[model samples]
Target: MSLIELHTRSLELAAELIDTVQPEQLVLPTPCADWSLRRLMEHVVGQHRGFAAAARGAGPDRALWRDAPVGADPGGAFRGSAAELTAAFTAAAGTPGRSRLWLPEIRDGGPFPLDLAVGFHLLDTLVHAWDVAAALGPSSAAGIAAAVEAEPPLAGALLAVAEVVPAAPADRGPGRAFAPGRAPATAAGSFGRALALLGRDPDWAPPAR
Candidate 1:
């Protein structure tokens, strides 16, 4: 499958997970340190818009990267942003000089290739979808996410990317791409190992609520 296909799948998975979030659960903490589930979602929605802008050569503008408010319908907001990104990326794939476009929000906004730009978003969607699932804990939402992860194509693509991303450095914390690495459990599957590579514990559950 294409990177766009994988990215779109991740976004869809994220939307489904978001749809399962209860109103009271919005304030719950997520794997991203210091960010509640709502706050983490704010960043995810903002990132979708920012990346969409970048695909169209307008990414240098910082305003698009601003944290958006989690409105009354978080799932709706997530789907909207995901759709925007999907359209932008589809359009960008055909646009002339797309390879020259840059994504400013990534590592000092270097002039990375278009494929890398999409890959970045794909990776974010994969990890953050897991974050949402983990926040929801052992529920229908998590089961939904786990079922999707069991698909070889999706997990394989994510694993391919995760394996290449180096473990987070000692200074790792909020604002960095990933957290400190954790050892994968002996019984871990491909998806579990992938999460481990991305500095998340597959067995993690929310604190007593």
Candidate 2:
């Protein structure tokens, strides 16, 4: 319910998703058409670090997160990014209500309320968990639920922002229509399926693959 709880839960789900990735599977295609597993992971870690940076008062330029930046060890790089995000968020949680975050590209303008920092990350973590879980098969539902339960605020935010701005991860491709307060006609196959209905799909499966 709180931002800190949401951040922690998102981190936990993300870790679970990361654990599902085999070394060989890292190169495998994911639901997100343009991103392989590795790329999707990179994007996740990058967004975390970027958001943490903003919460720490650093803007996009100084943000530690980068898009597919070369690393000495790609795997280690991913882990490091996750770790960095965890630390940043942990510190932000300590401050509570006092910390600030800004993302001109995502939000309309100006920094978001210091309070909404965790809520923003919460939505990202939950949706991405579904993305990774769908690619890995049915084993990730628990993690998905964790993300969903951790961020009730995110659901409200999603309803508010669904049509206003683009959904997260940027790699999810085109936006789909979603009618607030209405469920889709078909049953959701997975957590990612539910996310797709909401106009967010970080792990959209590529048809060709």
Candidate 3:
């Protein structure tokens, strides 16, 4: 799948999971430590906005990347942000030149190549989609399936970017984004391996209430 296709599918899966979230589930714990479902949604919305801004050549504008507020209607808010992001990416799909993405989190604030930037976001969306599905507990078969479908494309996208994207320093440790984790013996599928590569325990599940 093309980067745009992968990104579009990622957003679709994310939106599906977001639509499943109930008000009571907002406080549920996710695989991402210390991030509640609501908090995770905030991060997702913020990233979409930031990426959208970057696609529009406003990569350096920090203000456009601000964390989106999760109001009472979290799903509605997410849908809006996702729509904006998808539109931006779709609009930029055929444009010339590499898209500049401002990534302040990295050591050198990067205006990274467009494909690389989209691939990075695609990776995050896949993993975070799993986080949400896992948080939804054992009943989330559809969500799990969506995540599984996302794996192969995600792997392909990451592999393509790996050659151009510099490897993180060894000393960066396990907590860094994209750090590999110990894959559980039971982690058999592509999604599981992808999760392990992203420093997530594929076997992780929310504690039973």
Candidate 4:
């Protein structure tokens, strides 16, 4: 599949997992160590807004990137943000001279190539989808894993980005997008290594309650 297709599938996966979140689950602990599900959802929604603005050359604007908390309807917020992001990316893909867009929130406020920028968003969407599914419990994670399997193109492209994600140990931590780095498991598959590189344990699960 193309980059746009992979990104679209990732967004769909995120939306699907987010739609399953119940009101009570919003307070549940998530894979992101310091964030409740609600906070993580806020960050995800904010990213959609930020990236959309960046795609339009309107960004590097911190306000758009900050966590825009939801009121009573986090799911509704997510849908709107997702649609905005999708539209922005789709438009950018076809427009000339928009190939190198400015993204203020990214490291050093990048003017990254459109394809690379989309990959960055795609990987984030996929990981956050996993985070939400994990919070919903193991069955949800397994179900989403199966859903991803049904779309081989997305899974393959997701791993490709994960395995080659650009980051250094010094660049990861509490205030950053990724957690502290762990030693990569040489024997593991690309997915496992990718998770490790992304600072997530390949076998990580929520604590048993």
Q: 182-208 in candidate 4: lDDT tens per residue?
A: 677777444445567788765567777
Model 3 vs. true fold: TM: 0.82
What is candidate 3's lDDT per residue for 90-198, written digit by digit as tens? 7776677636667665447587777777887776776777778878875573456445555776556644443333444662345565544555347355555455555
* CA RMSD of each candidate after superposition: 2.0, 5.5, 3.2, 2.3
**Predicted candidate 2 versus true structure: per-residue lDDT over 1-209, tens digit per residue:** 65565456556656755665676666766655556767777777777768767767675463455665523344455456667766776776577663666665464535676556565566666666666676666446445654554555544453333333344454233442222222433644334344654554433444663
TM-score of 1: 0.90
Error of 3 at 153 (Å): 3.9
Q: Candidate 3: misplaced stretches above 4 Å? A: 145-147, 150-155, 158-175, 178-180, 184-187, 207-209
In candidate 4, residue 12 scores what lDDT?
79
RMSD of 1: 2.0
lDDT score, candidate 1, position 17: 76
Please list the residue runs of candidate 2 whose C-alpha ends up more than 4 Å from where it truly belongs after superposition: 68-80, 93-98, 138-197, 200-209
Query: What is candidate 2's TM-score against the reference?
Result: 0.67
Candidate 2: minimum summed lDDT over ten consecutive residues — where? 176-185
lDDT of 4: 0.79
- Number of the top lDDT candidate: 4
Worst 10 residues of 3 by lDDT: 158-167
TM-score of each: 0.90, 0.67, 0.82, 0.89
